[model samples]
Target: MMAAHGAPWFAGWGTLALVNAGLAQGKNRSGLGWFLLSLLLGPLATLLLVLLPKVRDRMF
Candidate 1:
């Protein structure tokens, strides 16, 4: 059925979202925000994360 064919795709997308979340966290970004964004943007989110610079903490 159509559902069977789409299940793997959905699973992969979900996995990618998790990976993006971790990647975001590694860059000192919000994991949950990236996770939600990834759920909507998928690979595009990964590309954005890759292109983004890491956040540095300021010692004010």
Candidate 2:
């Protein structure tokens, strides 16, 4: 768990890079917008990520 949390500095940045790449293909920029917002709003970001329709679709 410690490693997992620490992974965010590098790994999480990588994940965000990939997600940003994917978002770039679309016309709507809100996906990236929300992500940047999350960095400032941690729990809210987690909640927003959790509540996203597309994200939730994949989890279960």
Candidate 3:
């Protein structure tokens, strides 16, 4: 499917992955991990990040 559109398609996907990574970090999550996951899950990953609650900081 993506092959038909070529670089532009993958470029958009890659850009979305980067944006998702930033979103993850903003929520106190691992950006690198989420970026990797985004490569596979794409928009689904973004939906998950948006729906999930932010991690609360703990004083220990």
Candidate 4:
């Protein structure tokens, strides 16, 4: 039934995922991993990303 609305419903989530991916990369984390996680966990993944500790002593 929800499918009737199509991807539009989740379009916001997709945008959020892209933004989260960039945030993950900035934090020296895996952008792809966060992108995948956002697909399943949605906004919750974003919250987790926000709360996760940043990598110290970055190689680059």
Model 3, stretches more than 4 Å misplaced? 1-4
For model 4, what is the error of residue 49's alpha carbon versus the real structure, in angstroms, after optimal superposition?
Answer: 0.7
**Candidate 1: tens digits of C-alpha lDDT, residues 1-51:** 345888899999999999999999999999999999999999999999999
Clash pairs detected, candidate 3: none
User: What are the runs in model 1 whose C-alpha is more than 4 Å off?
Assistant: 1-3, 58-60
Q: Give the per-residue lDDT of model 2 (tens digit) for 1-60.
A: 345667657666556644653443242336666556645654555554554555322343
Every candidate's lDDT = 0.97, 0.52, 0.95, 0.90
Residue by residue across 2-59, what tens digits does model 3's lDDT show? 4665888899999999999999999999999999999999999999999999998768
* Global Cα RMSD, each model: 2.2, 9.8, 3.8, 3.4
TM-score rank order: 1, 3, 4, 2
Q: Global CA lDDT of candidate 1, please?
A: 0.97
Better candidate number, 1 or 2, judged by TM-score: 1
Higher lDDT: candidate 1 or 4?
1
Q: Candidate 2: global Cα-lDDT?
A: 0.52
Error in Å for residue 33 of model 1: 0.3
Q: What is the TM-score of each candidate against the true structure?
A: 0.88, 0.33, 0.87, 0.80
